[model samples]
Target: MSSPGDLPDAEVVPKKRWRIPWIWVVPAVAVLIGIWLAVQTVLEKGPTVTISFKTGEGLEAGKTKIKFKDVEIGIVKSVVLSKDYTRVVATAELTRDTANMLVDDTRFWVVRPRVAGGSVSGIGTLLSGAYIGMDIGRGKDARRDYTGLETPPVFASDVPGRQFVLRAADLGSVDVGTPIYFRRLQVGQVTAFELDKDGSGVTLHVFINSPYDRYVNADSRFWQASGLDVTLSTDGLKVNTQSLVSMLIGGLAFETPAASLSWAQAPANTTFTLFQTRSEALRVHEHIVETYVFNFTGSVRGLAVGAPVEFRGIPIGEVAAINTRFDPVTRQISIPVEVKLYPERFTSRFESGPKKGRLTNDPKALANFLVANGLRAQLRTGSLLTGQLYVALEFFPDAKKASIDWSRTPPEMPTTPSGLASLQDSINRIMTRIDKLPIEQLTASAQQTLDNTSALMQNLNTQVVPQATNTLAAARAALEAAHSTLLPGSGLQQDTTEAIRELTRTAASFRSLADYLQEHPEALLRGKPEDKK
Candidate 1:
């Protein structure tokens, strides 16, 4: 008010000024920033989903991360029990990148330390902590709520391969992810397996990847390659498939026949039989025309199913099975071995070479033929190391001549124990002979000799030895006295020297008398001739 009056000459305008409270200015700016950050966070959040977990063991409210193919795409915002309290529900805020990942086919699981298919995996979770693992999928419809898998799949759902079913005797050794090998190279794995429909065996579902699957054809063979295949044969010890990894993890192998004419490739879902060994898969098995039961009294410890039945060093059949039967009447146990003989094994040979006569199959004719040739069934050791025994057919002229025992259903053939049983018999005989020997008499004689020796020793020690000792002591004293006397001019030494001279003269006189008596015929009744003169 004083400014306009004071400035009389000059027209002065009041200066305009503006001021704000500095204390509240900073607070207003901070509030704007906070609002903006919240809006940005809301916009960036892709989706919210509820995941049900069997357990909430390794989860933390703000730390458990959700990953797809090992890439973190979301984080758990909260972890709590479900309404029913049956499972744990994890609420997650996913990144914008996972918008499409919330699909019907997507899978989620907890990643922790686990052992699957005989292999240890997810061991890193021991240190870094367990997190949620998600696998994305190509799904048409989107889904938010999901259930987590209890166990992880052996293979990813998107893996490219063809599945095949393999039937085997048992599935004890095999497990999921067990390797399937091709020529010892790992090319596939076991996906799943279950008992066969009939429950007689097991069926394994296997998947083989491309490029290697082509090798499996219609004529292909599959066998277990999960253990050491040591063959004890006459050729020598042959170790097959000694891979330590394959043996521990268990595995299967496939091979197509080299000389086979069929090379048809197997299609998807094709069925195949899994054999125990490669040789079993490759053997040529034919129909058995006749079944024979050999009631063997000999030991069949080393004999087993599939033991070869050889005739003249060539395999003509094989043992189908072995069992023990008790004859109540006889009160003895007998091993009944079922055998299958194929005619083709012998026919093929006769067709190719000497066709002098046809080997008849009639039971009576065959029995006569075997009897004429002295053919007998014998148990022979196939492998000494393993003690595996096989049946051998050979001529045994010295065998107890028994005619064909065709009265029984599966006519029992004339049998003999080959070298295996013979050696055992010889040992038994030697043991029996040793048992019968006169050990008692020998022991008695030895004791008598010991007693006689003891008595003689006692006599020598008590009587004869003492007398000899006294005699030795007397001779030693005499020798000492003689030495003392001979040292100087002792009278005893002189007397001894004179006595030796006189004995020498007497000996000379006797010699002369005998000489004179021999020269004279009429001496003494006849005195000596010199004395008579």
Candidate 2:
């Protein structure tokens, strides 16, 4: 404080100010932020998984992304050869959200552009390149490794439907992803199909979506609906499924009979038989309680197992089989046809008592019933165009008497000859009767009678002509004499008048002589005649 020149004069040394350097502090904070970012980057990096594939086609490390539900979820970090150098192992880094999808049962497959089984898929991949698709399959566990599938599965785990199995003789025009129809409406699809274990046929696994699945019942029938089924029936050609889609890709359809209520909804994984046609399904069960064997001596070419068995113009059953063997009775190459009769089909609901019990159920009663009614089986033509033969049952009052023995194993029925055979028999009988006639003998007798008549006519012409001529000449001479006598001025007329006058005179003298002779005879006889004279 002493400063006055040193004296107490205020020493004004410019005030030293306390100012902060903001530039240096800002730099320190920036350096700390840089350190923090590096640590977080290391901590947030997700875990990786390894997948094995047959080939590394359409894959590139760090370039190809793995997706789920069409959303990008991971990237292929690396692709390398297996230790055996025979396969590829692809390592992928997934997002944190995919943690739950990492399960033991998870599935993975690459999505690529391709066509298979009549369907085109993975079209989006054409523009964006190929990708890995993942599905969290049927489990709740976690996994870090998997073996990817070469092809996509028929259905996703999340699809809602019921699966069933069907057995068919041959998979004609059927393929995976084929549409299944119900009343001409698409309702389901075929999932997987494989040849049967025993090589007998093929087995198909199909799925029907909800709502539509309810339509399937135990009694439902399924048949192929592909191509054109042209049936030349009596009515006309019956064509089926002419649609281009069906003809190309093929399809299947089902029908729930009117008696669907006989059973409940079909259970999952239910097994069924796939028929080739609708008619085949109808002829499935003969349900024949009464079996009768008919021996057909005629042609059985068109007769088959499904041939109709009719009774009095009503359908009663079908032909169970047509077999050739030595019959027990005929002991010849008789075509013993097994026809099954379904009595319930013919018995009306109005019948009751012993008659109500179907004859098919009781062979003994049926035999008696048939005998009393004089029922016999005969073969008839069902379709003239198809040449299909069928069995016909009818009653003939005076039919050749026959009987049925129900005690036999299969119960035999009285059989009459086929319609064609009966006609042939009648024709042979007529020919036999005509052959027995004496045609040659009759011709010879007729010829002899004509010769005799000709000879008689010749004799009359030669003998009678001369005698008749002589008689006519004699009669002509007599006529000439009579004509001359009858002439008015002829000599015969004058002589007749003179003769009459002489006769009158002679008659007068005879009268007088007679009177005198009478008197003289009286006088001579009795003297008294003299006086009278």
Candidate 3:
């Protein structure tokens, strides 16, 4: 019991005591409250996630946070290198509630910065250092670690696209990230490029979006859209320079308005065949044997390995390889071009059998077909500006047939084929020859011909016409005198009347004689002495 100021006593409880001093109790209670708070924080385990990237420039282990729509979900726990050493692995921790929200497809990209397609993104993240952007999908799974995707946010909702691997000869300074356009609209991009193993070709990796991919096919032709487009006009050709971006990076466009086939959706990582536009004329057949070797022993300055080898306006093969071999005995350098041909390209239309079971690559069968149809190989000009020669297969009904022996020395190739190049050269030669022709002598001869014609016409007009006119005048005078003497009408008498009747009978006889002479010019040559009546 404890006593107040008065002597009265109050009920006394036991003096309660803490195991420790009161001063220590205050700190002990505080320690318990702190422990309880730490436990509560530990129990609320946030979502756990991971992301892979090439670099971790602005990302930090403890500082970097991952958020979804500004709501903080998780924090990056650790940064480590993957086993492959090709990527950076970032471990993250999230709240329990947010942890179940991460689905397999949930994206955790490091939102730093990016610049492309004429747009700059993620500039806000630059100031905030680097943050893990968490696109948490709805899911119901216990908290676990996830191996994030290697690629960036390639939105599936965005127009799905296909990839095209184009092999071009002269991509000349074409860089990665080049835009591929269709009718001036950017439809794709050149993602990557590398020289082929042989260094003879360049393989270009191109990606095109959804419907744009459907436009290309086996026969679609592609050309570099660079420099300026030219159009012929009355004021000469007008050149319209394209955009600077298109000129530097150099884009590619295709046009093929033929039959449309089913769209082929080539999956990612699938390899599609690439063909060079310049080498499209080259035909290769694995099963076809070497048939005829044609010798083109002439200057091949502009010829290349992939040069067009045409026959009768048809592309039969390409110049696979070219070499100059000196014939020691003849002391002449001859160019030998090895050409690869696809005999299967020539189909036998004259097959009498079923279409499906028709004979294929039969030389004799095809030769007979050609014999009846008449086939010939003429030099065709490939490029007039470049003077490139290509063989063209043609049919000439009036051309003489020439036999070819495989063992004999081949004939010299024509200087120029009947191609555009040959036509240009022929025109030039004709102009040169005309300039050197003897024009003075031709002018003299023409003048002499004109003078002779004029003289002949003058002789017929003056001498011949006057003689005929005089004969006619004299005959008329004689007729008038005879008529006056014969008809004395009222001036003469009975003798004038008798003479007039005789004169009329004589005139009728003379008219009959003139008619007979006019009908027979050749009869004049069969001359007979005139009898005096």
Candidate 4:
């Protein structure tokens, strides 16, 4: 090598190209893969959400999944206690596709084993561990932070149905999740209940599923079917039950009356009244009620509030109240019964009659006429077995005339004693008449007669009986003497036998003589000549 000079000449040749070491090639490839992975991780990432729960039970960071309709859509990244420590907060990462599903009304709850509302649910979580369940909301606003539910909803939002509201005097046995029945078939459930703000009643929210919702109409009557409805009336014992479940856990039943079946379907969230019984639900609504009071003189022990008030045998009203009033001056106690009468009930029957408008137009005149004609209210036994009494209006021709007191707040009607009371009064009168008689004197007279009879019997037993006995002995002696005289073996019998034989001989001689005389006399008489001996 001619040294530097030669090297300079060789410098014109291209310097050896820079070549990377094989070890570095491996590092380069690794760096490129790491960059690509970072970019992919960034691209696939989605929005983060925070969910607050009562507890951290069944949740695991990086392992717990967030699912909707059983499809995994997100995962829990971390879990920590809330600031106040009242709950646990979970941070979750959801795919980008689920970003729109986060809504104001979105629901989240843990899927775990739970028993409620007469049902067992979330059984699959026992094997798969618990997961966060999500229900998409119909809300318009979007949200990320959420409050999880302690329990799953009874119905999914997607379920096709309608809701309604019911007002009741009391909650009775009804509770959330109680079944609602249509003709004994379960068609819906109670979703919620709240006490009225005024504390006078309860408000219930119910949901009817799909096709069953169509059956609910504006005229539908709802009643509590929680227990057995047993009625003891003139028709006899009636026991009604909707179902075994209803009897045990309680339920609701609704039906449109046969006459109102053509009514329009009730819209969603329609309000309705919940009645206590089917009868009450189906009873004709009477808007025009007239209040009347009756002062009864007899005991009203069997008469109670709500007792039927009848015109003849038909019910036209009911007893609203029963009150006892004591007249201090007279020292007498009377029962004042308040009754609610539906005049329409009677008017409807005579709608086509001439008296229809007359009665409605001038009720006071009709009342006066009825009273003048002896219309009286009386307490009558409705059920002898139950000892239940009801009010009855009847025409009593013999009753004393009475008039209604129109000046009273509730007009006062005249009343008569019940049949039982009348009988009691008659018995009392008879007892009074008997009491007025001289009972002591009558008893004394009867005792005196008895004493005389006893004395007479004693005298007969002593004197008369002895004399009679002596006379009977004498008679018996006479009979013995006669019997002895009639004996055939005695001396008299022998003498009699001898006389009879002598008489026989004499008789034969006379016969011979008579025959001779008869032959001699036959010549003169021509009668005994035929006897030629």
13-51: candidate 2 lDDT, tens digit per residue: 888898768878888898899888887766666668999
Best-performing candidate as measured by lDDT: 4
402-463 per-residue lDDT for model 3 (tens digits):
44443433322222234444567789999999999999999999999999999999998999
Candidate 4 local lDDT, 103-211, one digit each (tens): 8999999999986656688899899999999999999899999999887777888999999999999999987788999999999999888999999999999999999
Query: Residue 52 in candidate 4 has what lDDT?
Result: 97
Question: How much is 527 displaced in model 1, in angstroms?
Answer: 72
Q: Candidate 2, overall lDDT? A: 0.81
Error of 1 at 496 (Å): 55
Judging by TM-score against the true structure, name the best candidate. Answer: 4
TM-score of each: 0.57, 0.69, 0.51, 0.79
* Local distance difference test, each candidate: 0.82, 0.81, 0.62, 0.90
Q: Global CA lDDT of candidate 4, please? A: 0.90
Model 1, range 431-489, lDDT digits (tens) per residue?
Answer: 99999999999999999999999999999999999999999999999999879888767
Q: How many pairs collide in each candidate, listed in order?
A: 4, 9, 17, 0
Kindly report which residue pairs in candidate 1 clash with one another.
522-526, 523-526, 523-527, 524-527
Better of 2 and 3 by lDDT: 2
